[model samples]
Target: MKKEFRSGCPISSTLDVIGDKWSLLIIRDMLIKHKKTFKEISDSDESIAPSILSARLKLLESYKLISKIKIPKNKKENIYLLTEKGIRLTPIIIEFSLWGDTNMREFNKIKDVKGLNLDKSYIIQSVQDHYNSMLLNF
Candidate 1:
């Protein structure tokens, strides 16, 4: 169930919906890894618990941020895909990643890390291109 907003502040409202660490990590998995299945999402680097993952998925769906679609070829399997609303979060995710890359010393030292240019328009464009390609394949 969605929580009631405490005030009209935009940030607060946004946080109310997605402030939890796990929620954004789930989004990150979808955006970066293109994971869809429950197993795939829960198997991310962050090692989210199955119960937490299930709850977050429900919340994301309730907020219209993602859609759970059953693959046409498989009756028992469903894949989660970002809605237009969820795709809008790409820029924010890019900014957060850039911040971590820049300020977090440990993150920078990670092996084979390809740094983004920190250009907002370029990042958004790149994400849009990827999203478009995914749509074509879907």
Candidate 2:
């Protein structure tokens, strides 16, 4: 069940759901790196602990930001995919990336990622396109 917040403020409500560093980082991995599996996500540069990863995954899934799918041929493994609500976070992610790139010296390391053009409109369109394609396949 979704947790109740102190008030109905949008920012506070958003924070209540995904305010933690790990949660957003997990979302970043999925949004930017396209990681879908536990192993893949755990291998991110942040190196989150397995226990913490599991908890955060549960929280994200509970909020309907992501969905866990059992791998057809590998029952022991599950893949995660973003829902429409999650896809809507692309702009915020891009804005954060831009902020990091502008303020931090090491932020440019991943700036050259293919299809991740610095153009805001392009990034938004790319995210929407990817989401639409995934829906079609589903």
Q: lDDT of each structure?
A: 0.84, 0.83
Q: List candidate 2 segments past 4 Å from native.
A: 106-117, 131-138
Q: Candidate 2's residue-wise lDDT over 1-138, tens digit each? A: 667886899999999888887988898888767788999999998899999999999999999999999988999999998888998888888777766766774644544444444578888778768765765675
Error of 2 at 28 (Å): 1.4
lDDT of 1 by residue, 1-138 (tens): 856887899999899888888888888788777888899999997899999999999999999998998888997988999888998898888887777766886755743346485467887778767875886798
Instruction: Please name the candidate that would achieve the greatest TM-score relative to the true structure.
Output: 1
The ten-residue window of minimal lDDT in model 2 covers 108-117
- C-alpha positional error of residue 106 in candidate 2 after TM-score superposition, expressed in Å: 8.0
Give TM per candidate: 0.90, 0.84
